[model samples]
Each structure stands twice: as structure tokens, then as C-alpha cells.
Target: MFVPFLIMLREGLEAALIVSLIASYLKRTQRTQWFGAMWAGVFIAAGLCLALGIFINQTTGEFPQKQQELFEGIVAVIAVLILTYMVFWMRKVARNVKAELEDAVDQALQKGANSGWPLVLMVFLAVAREGLESVFFLLAAFTQDVGYAPPIGAMLGLATAVVLGALLYVGGVRLNLAKFFKWTSLFILFVAAGLAAGAIRAFHEAGLWNSFQAVAFDLSNVLSTQTVFGTLLEGILGYQEAPTVSEVAVYLIYLIPALLLFLMPARPAASATKDAREASSARR
Candidate 1:
């Protein structure tokens, strides 16, 4: 519950932040009239995302056990891919996001009298990117356990994001957007990696891929998914006892590289500040 909530909050706020940033930019430049269009894009994107989640849930509801397993495997792999991409992409773009957005808006409005669609396009693309990402993630998560928790988690996440987004716009909260994304991206990477392994497990169950089917270890004796500690591991880390060799391999393979990549400093300290300033200046 908490996990999904936090995910939604972070992702949701990120989207909200994008919308707010554009709105603020327009307001500053005496272009407030098109604000409604920006919002229309955002709301429409969000609705599409909701519809996507619903479709996944409803579609999987009728599958047999084997088909369900296959679906889970596919969804998990996709989740891992998207999450990993986000992790790397965030690291790469953290400093330049503001500049990029500002530039985009600038280019859009440069058309003068006919800049409305361009502005709307920028906001729409940004918001929809986040929305589609969230939708895929929710789909993967919903298939994992198939209950109220996933949706609840999503709602909680979005709710938290709303609060944070409001706070950010109001000029009260002090946020280090860089480090915040770093840590959360790292966490999300691991979660996605675990899901990736779980995906492998699901495929094995569905008899899709049969490579390295041996059990790495039997942790069931020490802990079961039903146990308190086990539940925590499962919820946060996507742990499964008696995981096959392929699962373990995929999980570790995904984690080590992702963690190292995430931890790798984007810039040396001596130059990072200067870069950040330059980037910020470009945006301003």
C-alpha cells in the first residue's frame, strides 16, 4: 500500500511539476490564456492512463492460470524496462530538465500569434509521457497480486504528488530535485529488477522459457511470503522463495549494473556546480 502510494506520489508530482512549470512560465510571460489548453492536455492524458490500467485489469481477469502467468511475466519485463529507462534517463537529464522545458516553450511561443498549439503540444507531450509511464507501471503492479492494494497504492502515490506539487508551486517547500530523483530512481530500479526476475519466474511457470530452471535456494524454511518479514520483502523487493536460477541471475544482473550506473556521478564535483548553474541560467 505504502509502496504504491509513494510511487504514485513521486510520479504524479513529477507530472504535476511539469504542468505547473509550464503554467508558471506562461503566466510570467503574459500568456495565461492558453493555460486551459495545457490543462486539457494533462486531464486527457490522465484519463487515457486510467483507461489503460482498467483495460489491463479487465483483460487479465478472464485468463486461465497459465495465460495469467504469461501475462504477469510480460508485464513485469515491461515494467522493468520502463523503470530502468526512467532511471538512466533521469540521471542523464536531471540537470537539464528545466533548460530543456524552457527552451521547448520558447520555441513553441516563438511562432507568436499561432503558438498556442505548440505550447499545448509541449505540455501534452510532457504530461502524457509521465502518464503513459505511470499507466504501464500500474499495469505491471496490478497483475502481480491482483487486488485493491495496487490501485490503492497508485491513488496514494498520486495524492502525495498532488500535495507536493501544490507545495512546490506555492514556494514553501525546499526540494533538491536532483538528489530526490537520484535516490528514488535507484529504489525504483531495484524494484523493477526484482519484477524482472519475477517476470522470468512467471514465464517459467507458463512454460515459455526453460533456461536455468533450477532453484537457487530454498528460503521458504526461513521465511514465507505469508510471513511478516517475507511480506515486506515481497512488497518492496518482489521477493519469491525458491526462485529459479534464471530469476536469480536476471535479478542480480539487472541490479548490479543499474546500481552502478545510478551511483556513477554524472559530473565531478568541481564541474557539477558550474554545469548546474549554466543549465539553470539557460533555463532562466
Candidate 2:
């Protein structure tokens, strides 16, 4: 649950920041009249994303119970791959995102009416990237937990991000965005590891895997989901009362590397920030 919220929140903030940058630039250049078309494009892309999400949710419901587990297991695996890629990619490439975006804007403005399609394409691609990431993550998370909470988490995250983004734009708040992204990526790494393990367990249950299915341990006797701490663990980290050997193996295999990468040295976020600033300045 926390994973979904955090993932969506972070992604939403990225998108919000991009849109805000475009909007602000338009206003500054007295091309504010283009704002209406920009908003319309944004809304259209958003609506399409919403429809796509709904379609995915409803599609998952059509499978038989056990088959659903198998399908979910597969989807979770896909989610793991994509999520892991995103974490590392961002670590390596996030700094120049702002500058790359600014260059696109400059090119579009230079073209005038030809800019309309480019603007539409840029907004669609940015928001859709975020939306696609959210859709896959929710699919994976919802499969692990039994309930209505994942969707609730996503909505909460998106709403909260929007509020925070608006405040940042309106001079109502300030955040160390570099630190925010760095820390949150670490959090997401843990979540992805849990999904890796949980999905493996699901596949075993669905008859896809047969190795190392022994019951690793049972904690239900002492700690039940009915208990507060138990429920929190279950929601936050996919804790199970009686996890199988394969589940534990998959979880740790994913967790250990993810944790190491997150904790290990990488290029400083400040360096990325500096590079981005320099790039933006060069463009200007």
C-alpha cells in the first residue's frame, strides 16, 4: 500500500513539475494564450490514462481465481523488471531531464503553430510515461494484497502530489527535490523486492513453479493480520504468516541487491542537479 502511494506520488510529482515548467515558460514569454491548448491537451491525455487504468483493473477481474493468481504472477514479474529499470535509469539520467524538456520547448516555440502537435506529443508522452508506470505497479501491488486499498493508495498519492506541486508553484512551499527523489527511490527499491518475492510465491501457488516450496516459518500463531503491527507489515512489505522457502528466497534475492544499490555510492544528486542547471542555462 505504501509502495503504491509512494510510487504514484513520486511519479506524479515529476509529471507535475514538467507541466508547471511548460506553463510558467508560456506565461513568461507572453505566449500565455497557448495555455488553453496546453491544458486541453493535458486533460485529454489524463482522461485517456484514466480510461486505460480502468480497463486494466476490469480486465484483471475476468480471470478465474487461481488463474488470476497466475496472471498476476506474470504481470508482477513484468512490473519488477520495469520498476528496477526505472530506479537505475533515474539514478543515472535524471539530472538532465529538465534541460531536455526545455530544449523541446524551445524547438516548439520556434515553430509557432507547428508547435501545437509537438506540444501535444510532449504532454502526452510525459503524462503517459507516468501513467504507464502507475498502471503496472498497481497491477502488481493489488495482486499481492487482498482488498480495495491499493486503488485508495494511488488516489491518495496522486491527490497529495498535485497539492504539493501546486503549492511549490505558488510559492507556498519549498522542497529539496533532489533529496526527495533520492530517498524515495530507495523506498521504491524495497517495495519492488517484496513484489519480486510475492510474485514468485503466487506463481508457485498457481502451479507454475515447484522448487523450494517448503513452509519457511509460521508467525500467524503469534502475529496475526488482525493485529496492528501485523497488518502494517502486511500492507507495507507483503508479510505473510507462513511464507514458503521460495518466497523467502525470492524476497531476499531481490531485496539484498536492491538495498545494496540504494545504499551504495552513486553519482551525487547534486551533480545531476548542477548538470541540469548548466544545460538549461546553455539553452537560454
Candidate 3:
């Protein structure tokens, strides 16, 4: 539940930031009349994401047990891959995101009053990317365990992000977004690792993976998965009382290198920080 909460928080914040930037640009340029187009794009993107997520969920539910495991395993792997790429991609591209978005807004507005397609398309694509990413991650998260907590957590996270975005836009609050993302990225890395392990376990259950079937360790006596605390750990951290060798191997392989790369310093990061701070200030 906590993992899903953070995932939604991060993804929702990204979408909110995009929409906030577009709205800020529109207001600053005295083009408030075109606000309808911006909102249309946001709604369309959100609706599409919701539809896609629901369709995926419903389709997977009709499968047989073995097929269900296979499908879940595949989706989990895809989610982890996408999550890992997303984290690194954001690290690489976040600095330029503000300027690029502003540039896109300028282009969209330059097209003028004859049609709102330019602005609408721009905002739709921007928001849709974040929305779809969230959908896939959430689907994988929901597949991991049986419960209502993850979805509830996700809803709360999104609501909080919307509020935060509003506060930022209204100049009611200031945040060091760079630091926030850095810390969150670290947490997300662990979450993705857990997801990967779960995927391996799922594959094993589906009979698609047989190697390394040996139990690396068993803690069921002390930490039974049926317990509330154990369930929480399993849901959030992919904790298994008796983890198979392959699961542990995959977890370590993904987390260690991913963390190393994520924590490594980038060249000339100070300038990027300056640009991000300037952009954040301008959004107000």
C-alpha cells in the first residue's frame, strides 16, 4: 500500500506539474480564454488512462490459473522495466523538462485562435504519458497481493499531489523538487526491485521458470505471511518467508546496479539545479 502511494504521488505530481506549467503559460500570456482546450486535453488523457487500466484488469481476471500467473508475471516484469527506465529517464531529463514544456506551450499558443488542436494535443500527450505510466505501475501493484489498501493508498496519493500542485501554482508553498525526486527515486528503486522478485516468483508458480527453485531461507516461523505485519511487508517490500533462490538473485541483481547508477553524480548538475529552481519560481 505504501509503495503504491508513493508511486501515485510521484506520477501524479509529474502530471500536475505539466498541467500547472501549461496553465501558467496561458495565464501569463493573456490567453486565459483558451483554458477550455487545456482542460479538454487533461480530461481526455485521464479518461483514456482509466479505460486502459480497467480493460487490462478485467481481461486478466478471466484467465485460468496457470495463464493468470503467466500474465501477471509478464505484466510485473514489464512494470519493473518501465519503472526502472522511468526513474533513470527522469534523472537524465528532469532539468530540461520545464524549458521544453514552456517551449511547447509557446508553439501551441502561436498557432492562435483559429483552432485549439495544437494546445490540446500538446497537453494531452504530456499528461497522458504520466497517466499511462501510473496505470501500468498500479496494475502491477494490484496484481501483487489481494487487498483494498493499495488502491486506497493510490487515491490518497493522487489527491495529495493535486493539492500540492495547486499550492505550488498559487504560490502558497515552495518545495525543493530536485531533493524530493532524488529521495523518492531511491525509494522507488527498492520498490521496483521487490516487484521484480515478485515477478520471478510468479513465473515460478506458472511453471515457466524452474531453475534456482531451492529455498534460500525460510522465516515463516517468526514472520508468517498470514500475519498483518507480514502481509504489509509482503505487499510493500515483496517479503517472502521462504524466498526461492531465483527471487533473491533477481532482487539483488536489479537493486545493486540500479542503485549504484541512480546515486552516481551526473556531470554539471549545479546548472541543472539552477534551471529547475528558476522554472519552479516562474511557475508561481
Instruction: Give the number of the best model, judged by lDDT.
Output: 3
lDDT of 1 by residue, 1-284 (tens): 65577677768878978877877777777878887778877887788877887877787789999998998888888778887887777677666666567667777767645657776676778888887777777777776666788787888789878888878877878788877887788789878987898888899889998999888999999899889989888888899878888989999998998888777767643455456556556655
Give residue 64's error in model 2 in angstroms: 2.1
Candidate 2 wrongly placed segments (more than 4 Å): 111-113, 268-279
Q: What is candidate 3's lDDT per residue for 1-284, written digit by digit as tens?
A: 78888989999998888888778877886888889999999999999999999999998898999899998899888888878988987898677777777767766867855788898999999899888889889988898866898899999999999998998889898989899888998888888899999999889889999999999999999999999999888888888999999999999999999999988886555675566556645754
Candidates' C-alpha lDDT: 0.79, 0.79, 0.87
Give the backbone clash total of model 2: 0
Pick the winner on lDDT between candidates 1 and 3: 3
Worst 10 residues of 1 by lDDT: 268-277
- Give the range where candidate 3 is weakest over 10 consecutive residues by summed lDDT: 275-284
Of 1 and 2, the candidate ahead on TM-score is: 1
Q: What lDDT score is found at residue 94 in candidate 1?
A: 65
Question: Which pairs in model 2 have colliding backbones?
Answer: none
Off by over 4 Å in 3: 111-113, 269-284
**1-284, model 2: which lDDT tens digit per residue?**
67778888998898788788788777766777777666766787788878987887798798887898898888888888878877886776566676667666666656756457667776777777777777788888777766778788888999998998888777698988888888888877777777888888878878889999889999988998789999888877778888889899888998887878767777765665666567667755
TM-score ranking of the models:
3, 1, 2
